[model samples]
Target chain A: MNHSVRAVDRIAPRRQGNWDWRAAGNFVAGGAGGGVLACVAALSIGLGFDPRLLLAVGLAMMGFGLTCVWFEIGRPWRAMNVFRHVGSSWMTREAYVALFAMGTGLLAIGLGTRPLVAATGLLGLLFIYAQARILAANKGIPAWRHGRCLPVVLSTGLAEGAGLVACAGAWAAWWRYPAMLLVPLCAWRVIAWRRYLAALAADGAPVGTLTAFRRINSLFVWGGNLVPVVLAGVAVLADAPILAVLAGMLTVAAGWQMKYSLVCRAAFTQGFALPKQPVRGNSRTGPGVKPGWQWNRWLTD
Target chain B: MKRYAMVIDLRRCVGCQTCTAACKSANATPTGVQWRRVLDLESGEFPDVRRSFVPVACMHCANPPCEEVCPTTATKKRADGLVTIDYDICIGCANCIMACPYDARSIIHQPQYAYGDQPIASEAARMDSQHIGVATKCTFCKDRIDLAERTGQIPGRDPEVTPACVNSCISGAMHFGDILDSDSNVSRLLAENESFRMHEELGTAPAVHYILDRR
Candidate 1:
């Protein structure tokens, strides 16, 4: 190939200042890890007697999670003004949705309306979905780009939320539906775990600042993925709600690790291609270069 | 209707953060509120260092995601193409906060003080408690613009009131005008340079255009 030496030397080393490593790590760990724990807490609360009351408690926990998000910002107080750009802000939408979900859940509990609870539950699901979408929307973060994994993770989180609640609900009433729901939630968690690992493997790099995402992912597979599945299966076979609760806690912990790994390992890179140099002795360097002395000769020859 | 927009010539911008300061002063933004921020993105190795300052604010997109999600309809884009929030209707819910890609918005939980007000000042304590718990940001100095236009005191016989940040810009890097007008400075810059909007792929269609200082 008649490539100019200038072309070969054009690849410059890109520099990143400390890579916002701490902030990035904290963001991923807090967002994903906290999210999973919150989900588990919500599920456990929801399963308790008076699902509506539990839903309210779960929603309030979500509100606390919002505070964690604010802590990530340089100015937590100014978080309110975010509505100023509501016409163009996704965070605003997420906030409104969360508030609505919380309000509806509260109303359902206060008024003792099952229909309202179901409706709010559906909206809460959407709220969680939007949360995932918001993260995925960040093109700058490569780890969040997995479109497929987003919904899967969100649904799994929702299921985990419901499973925790179901375990509590079983104590109130001998309804096995919540436990049965755990079966699919567990399945979704596995699917999401597989997809996440596959994505990490395919990309050859975990997104963000955590260089050890793959290792963390392996831990999640063993702890979150395998343990939860086996325990839940055992709980189902044994007809033991206590065993189920234990398994659910394991699932939640593992999910948190998975979320942390996702955010911490994401990487962002500039997508522009560098300019190319013309081959020497070619007539194409008509105006810019001097004859018999090629531009970037120091690099070329 | 005039669609207000800003064109930043990053090549000429020294990254002095003069505009950021000017914006803070003009808007009377609180301690943690930053309507404008300069992101110093450093690329290339030490010997071949290249840094670009991306000063970001609200993009004022045509199809704003925040509006779509706002339950209170507190945020609305005016017919003139400026996105404004009705603070009275805002419920302090941080939905818009989470949705912003540029991290442009902030909620005000404390009182904002000017240069004269000290912590022990009697007026400071009173004023502090009054403005506490309100969401605030740059209205493009909307009050000043409105006052200037209403009083017919605008410079050069131009009927429109110019934003304070644009007026205080020393480098002339920030140009704001009606993007709808073909002869406007923002339009002219867009015609002349390879300007690009931030996060264009998200389909927010932000009004602000940046001429990147690619070294």
Candidate 2:
């Protein structure tokens, strides 16, 4: 999906400088943790397996991700002000949802109640959706602003969660219950990636951003998705717990890699454009200049 | 209904970057941060090249995307059609920075001086700690405009009341006034020239418009 981009990257949109490794860590850890919580809740509600250990681990992961973002902020004490714009801001919504998710998750663990666990799972799903909206709200970035980004984030988070469910099976006796669902979730995630990339290409993204996504395309499709699905299948065929854990680990790692790429590497701003290129002497305007966006559907002629 | 706007005449601009330096001197921004900048854009092939020096700053949009994504309500628009930042409440999340399509906003994490490792005499005197860790941008010389309003003088018509960049423009390429007022400098210039706002396709409805020609 490459274009004949002869222009230098400087002529195009520059990669966003605000968010970096710390911001990427939030999506990586938070998404995986929320996914794990949802997966555990679904299984507990259906199969009646007590996933107290993994559930606690899920909460801890989310908290750790929040801590990473706290460090990224300049005024840590003023962090409470993030709730100021609940009416419009997605970050505010994410915070409110997080507070509820934590409360329900704690009550669920303390009471050992099925309904509370189900509520926590619902909150986890909301958290993932909120996080996706957080990225998509950035109209500046080409990759984040795309409508297709929602499905990619949602599917990736759930896939990672299912992977963790498979990994948790290594310690728990009733591993077969959640591990059976891992292959299907991973496949769905791959399909999501395929659709997102195709849409992004057709819409036209920053050359560097598209290139970065392309670099991960093979690793994501082959090494990440196919290998994990194959390993999970082998685990089911041979009844091997280690193989299932390996598949889960690979799936989780791949999801993290994609998120990191999306947040850090592919976060390029929609650079400056001149709609009417000025000719030297003529009073009339010439062709427009959209540097990196060769096929931008949004460009007004 | 005073919707203040800036009009840059592309035909008159010489790409001297005087406006960029004027903005920095007026605002006292730290090293490596310029609220107003000139983008050197060269498009087309070898023989048919078209180069343009586009002077850009905050659009102070009618519909600001930065204001939409600010969790703390720090990035805000005033009644005078100026976009501003409330540094006191901003937690430095940089969300507004990501949401700004014009690349106008910036957050200076640490205190940086013009000179190597130390603030110069003037830099130290004017250095603001409030902007160190929060989102900051071009305020359309809000202070000057406000002062003019208090002093009972027209903002864009008076050089003392105008934005530093517009006053400093060497070739008279820049004009600033209430765009809603038909008789105002910006409104008259826009009415007479072929004008287009940058990234108007994004639905920002940017106040800063580029005038391609002079009628």
Candidate 3:
């Protein structure tokens, strides 16, 4: 998995700066929270009923994610400034949307209003979109900046939310319909994830990143996507409600794993690049130096 | 309309790292933080190898990615083409640090001195606690340039008004001037010599140019 070459430490890497575990956790928790709310809202509006679990769990997850991000900031007192950049920064917009989603969702659940629940669900989707953009806007990280990142993130959130609904559906029969969507959702996620990795390799991004994803490919593909699909299939075929709940839990866990690796492990910065090499005497021009990703490999290899 | 730029002559540079030392002292940077750096690159096979020193800092691009991704609009590019971060408003999210392709911006997590916990008097005077936990980079000595402008002195020409790295370069490898001005030294060099910017294909339009060595 060590695809990069290391050299001397004269030049620094840009990837050192970014959203760490707290940020990754925030995406997972918030996406799951909003996704759950959206699913519940749809169920309530379409079926003239809502699951209480969706309302409570969704908001709780979103709140937990926000709290994690809050703790991650170096300056806690200046946290409120996250709202100042709504016009430009996706992070700001995500914050505002999260607030709106929470407020409207709470009101919808408190008042037992179907229309309000629908609006909250729509806002929740918007919140997920904002989170996707927040990562994509980081142009330095080639893996995160690819076009597939948005769809992959959004679909995983939807799938995780659906899985949650299916798991909760074990108690309530009405939750089974959303659970059925998990297989297709997982399929979409796997496709998108594969496409993104291929694109990264094709674009000649850091070899280390390629190797890292390759090493973890089986986990993401089989553990995250395939396993959930099989479990959900078995739950449906065997008519076992308990098995359905297990499938839902597995799907949710897989979604979290995908995001955790994407934000923390797969995330690498576009290090410094020299377009032309400095020449001396009559020697042929040498290859340009890339210090950020290759430094370690250059030293050892 | 005045686009200030720096042109470093690769032939004249001796890889002394005097510019790195001068920049550290001038900025009073933290222990791990360096606003300017000299990278020594060794190319070719053992017997035929050649060494080149590349002095790097913030390129002050015309289209700056750092400013584009700043959540709080804290990283701003002035009309003179210098990119600066407003520490008071910065939330220390480190977004700009990731956005910058140059590896220019740094987030100071905590206070650290050259020696240890207790800093000397001069170091203590320069240490701004407020700067901690915010994105910071080379300002190209904006304070000195501002003072020179107010005092009716040319920025690149005046020894006291220029960047510390440019002033400290003993081999005269680094030259600073307004590229847009036809009469400026950098403009003349840019027109005459074969020069190139780093990662020009990225469309950053870096203000720093390197004059390739013919000898």
**Candidate 1 residues A1-301, lDDT tens each?**
1112121110211112222333333333323322333443344346543555556656665666666565544344555655444443455566776767767766877876656666666666666666676666544343554566585558556655645555555565543545555667767767775666465455432122224444565666667656766766776678777767776666666665565445444333222121221112332211111111112222122
Model 2 docking tier (incorrect/acceptable/medium/high)? medium
lDDT for each candidate structure: 0.55, 0.85, 0.78
Residue B182, candidate 3: C-alpha displacement in angstroms: 2.5
What's every prediction's RMSD, in angstroms?
9.9, 3.2, 3.5
Model 2 DockQ, alpha carbons vs. true complex: 0.58
Better of 1 and 2 by TM-score: 2
How far off is residue A106 in model 2, in Å?
1.2
The TM-scores of chain A alone, one per candidate, are 0.70, 0.93, 0.89
Choose the strongest candidate by lDDT: 2
1 versus 3: better lDDT goes to: 3
After superposition, the stretches of candidate 3 with alpha carbons farther than 4 Å from their true spots are A1-6, A10-18, A281-285, A291-301, B213-215
Question: Ranking under DockQ, best-scoring first?
Answer: 2, 3, 1
lDDT of 1 at A214: 44
Model 1, runs deviating above 4 Å: A1-146, A169-181, A193-216, A237-242, A252-301, B112-131, B147-160, B212-215
Model 3: number of backbone collisions:
10
Give TM per candidate: 0.63, 0.95, 0.92
**Model 2 lDDT tens row, A131-214:** 999998888887998989998899888888888888876767777665677888888889988888888877777777887888
Residue-level lDDT tens digits of model 3 in B1-215? 67789999875778899998999999888778899988776654656455667888899998887777777877888998888888899988887776666777777777888787898788788988877988889999999878876897877799888999999999998999888899998988878776789867667889999977443
Q: Which of candidates 2 and 3 is the stronger one according to DockQ?
A: 2
